[model samples]
Target: MKITGIETFCLRYRMPYALTYPRGEYQEREAVLVKVHTDDPNIYGWGEAAMWGGPFSTTTTVLEKQLQPLIVGQDPCCPEFLWEKIYQETYYHGRKGILLSCLSGIDIALWDILGKVAGQPLWRLLGGFARPIKAYASSGYYRRDYGLDALAADVGKAKSAGYRGYKMKVGNLGAAVHSRVLHETPLRVSFQEDIARVEAARQALGPNLDLMCDATTSLDAKTAMAYADEFERIGVRWFEEPTQPENISGCAELARRTRIPIAGFETETNKFNFAALMDAGAIQVVQPDVIQVGGITEARKIAAYAQMRHLTFSSKNYSTAVSLAACINLLYALPNADFFECDADPSPWREEFLKSPLFTFDDGIVQPFDRPGLGLDIDEVALSQWVVQP
Candidate 1:
C-alpha cells in the first residue's frame, strides 16, 4: 500500500531516579515517536527514535520538515530502498547524527508495516530463528544519594527478579565533581573506591551470574587498560565504551592490551565506521542501537558483518519500549546474539507507555513477541501526557 501520512511526537518523561554519568546528571528521558499511515485500511506502523540523554526536537524536526514530505506517496514495503533514498537525498546535509536518527525511525516504521502486511512476526519475517535471547539486567547507575551499599542492594534485587547477568555504570563524574576540574583532570574513578564498588556488586551477584561494566566513553586508553585488568580479575564479561567513541585507535589499543572484550559503537551511525573499528581489532563485542544506527535495515548489515568477523553482536538497550521491541526482533535473527540489554531502572515511560506487556524475564531469557509487526500497542492516552508541542 502507498504511504498516506506521517506523524511525529516529541515526548519527555521524568525518571523515578536520576542517573549520573561523566557528562552530568539526567532526571528525564526524551524520545521522538513516528507513526506511518498507509492507504490500506487499518494498517499503520510505529517507530521511535529515542534520545536516552540527548535532545529530541532536532530529530523530530528532521522527520517532519525534511524526510516525511519525501516518503508520503512512496511504497511502504521497500524499507531498504527508502532508507537509501533518504540517505542519498540528505547526504549534502551530512550522512550521520540527527539526520540518520530521523531516517532510522522511519525505516523501522516501514519494516513494521511490512511485517503486518505479511502476517508474520518481525523476527520470523527477518530470519525465522527460533531460539530465545538472554537478557542482562542493565542497571546500577550512580544515583543521587546512593553509594556502594545501595548499588549492592540493587544488584541483589535484580538477581532475585531472575536476571542472570548485570551491567553497572562506572566512570561517573570522573575524579572530581566540578565540571571545570573534570575537564582538566583525567576521566577515571578513584581506583580503590571503584574497585570496592565492583567488589560489593560481585559479592552480591555471586560468581555464577555474568557481569559487565560501561564506562560511557569517559576513560582514556591508559586508564581503561588499568580498569580492564581489575575488571578481568572480578570476572566482568565485557568493558563497554571505556574511552571516547571517536577514539578507534585508542579502543584498539585497549582491546589489544586486555583479555576482556571491548564492547562499544553505540554512538556510531554508519557501517563504514563500524568496519574501521572491526578492522582495528577494537571491539570484540559490538553493541549497535537499532534506533541510532539507521534502524533494523542498517543493524542487520552490521550484525552480518560482525558474524562474518566472528564477533559477538548485542544491542545497547536503554530506550523506549518501541526500541526494545525492534532490538528483540533484530537480535532473534542473529546467531551471534549474546545478551539483550534491558534497563533495570524503574520508570513509568518504560513500563506504562505501551498497552502490550513490557518484556518479562524468565530466568534471564526474553522471547520476541509472536504478534505481527513490532507487536506493540501504544498507549495514546499516556503518550498525550508526555507529548511536547512544536
Candidate 2:
C-alpha cells in the first residue's frame, strides 16, 4: 500500500531533576514521533527519531517540510528504497545529522506498516534471532548533589529492581567536547571520582551482575586504556564510546590494548561509518542507536556485518518508549543478540504514554512483543499534552 500521509509530534518532557551524561545535561527530554498513514486507514505505523542534542524543530522541520513530502505517495512496503531516496536527495546537507534522524523515523514507521500488512511482528519479520534477551540498567548520571552515597543508593535500587547488567557514566571532568558543542557545562566526574562511582555500584550490585561503563566520548584512548585496567579489575562488562566517534584509530587502539570489550559509536550515523569501525577493529560491540542510525534497514545491515565479523550488535537507546519498543524488536531480530540498553530514567513517555507495556521482564530477562508490526498500543491522549504545536 502507498503511504498517504505523515504526522509528526514534537514532544517535550520536563524531568523531575536534570539528567547529566558526560555529553551534556537534560533538564527536559525531547523526541520526535512519526505516524505514517497508508491507503488503508486501519494500517499505520509509529516511529521515533532522536532530536540530536538540539532543538526538536531541527529534525521535525525535515520530517514535516522536507522528507515527508518525498515519501507521501511512495510504496510503504519499499522502505529501503525510500530511505535511500531521501538520503541521496539530501546528501550534501543531510549526510550525518538530524536529517538522517528524520529519515530514520519515516523508515521505522514504514516498516511498521509492512509488518502489519504481513500480520507479523517486526522481530519475526526481521530475523527472530531471540525471543528473550538480557537488558542492562542505564542509569547513574552526574546529577547535582549526587554524592557517592547517593550514587550507591541509586545503583542499589537498579540492582534490586531486577536488572542483570548496569552502565554508569565515567571520565567527564577531563578532556571532553560536550560543553563546547552542547552550549552548557554538565556535571562531570574525574577518572578518580568515576572509579569510586563504579566501586560503589559494584559494591551495591554484589559483583555477579554485569557492570558496564559509558565514557560518552569523553576520554582519549590512552586515558581509557589506563582506566580499563581498573575496569577489568572491577569486572566491567564493556567500555562504551571510549573516545569520540571521529577517533576510530584511538578506539581501535584502546580495544586492542584492553581486555574489556570496547563498544561504541552510538553517535555515528549509517553503516559506512560502522563498517569503518569494524574494519579498523575499533569496536568489539557495535552499538548503534536505532534513531541516530538509519532505522531498521541500516541497523539490520550493521547486525549482519557484526554477525559475519563475530562481533556483538546491540542497541544504545536513550530516547523514548517508541524507540525503546523499536529497539526491543530490533534486539530480538539481531543475528548477534546482546543486552538491550534500558533507560532507567523514569518518565511518562516510558510508561504513561503507552496504552500498555510493550514487553515484560521475567526475573531479569526481557522478552519481545508477540503482536503485529511494532506491537504498540500508544495512548495518544496521554501523549497529547507533551506534543508541541507549531
Give the root-mean-square deviation of each candidate in angstroms.
2.3, 1.6
State the lDDT of candidate 2 residue by residue for 1-390, as single tens digits.
788888989888888899787767778877889999988889999998878667776777888898878988888988889988998999999878788788889888988988888999889988887657888889888889889899888788888889888899887764664446754656655668779898998898887899898888987778888889999888899998989999989888888888999998888998999999999999999999998798988888998999999998898888788898789998888768789888988677887887778898877888866888888888899899999863
Best by TM-score: 2
Cα lDDT of model 1 by residue, 1-390, tens digit: 799888888877787767766666667777788899999868988898745545666777788889988898999999999999999988898587877777888999999999999998888888966588877899877666787888899999988988878999787644432446556333335767777878899999999998898887877788888889999899999999888778889899999999999998798887887888999999999888899888899888988899899998998878778888888888887888889988877656666878777455688899876888887878889879888874
Each model's lDDT comes to 0.83, 0.85
| Cα lDDT, model 1, residue 274 | 86
TM-scores, in order shown? 0.95, 0.96
In model 1, what lDDT does residue 315 have? Answer: 87
Displacement of residue 88 (Cα, Å) in model 2 is 2.1
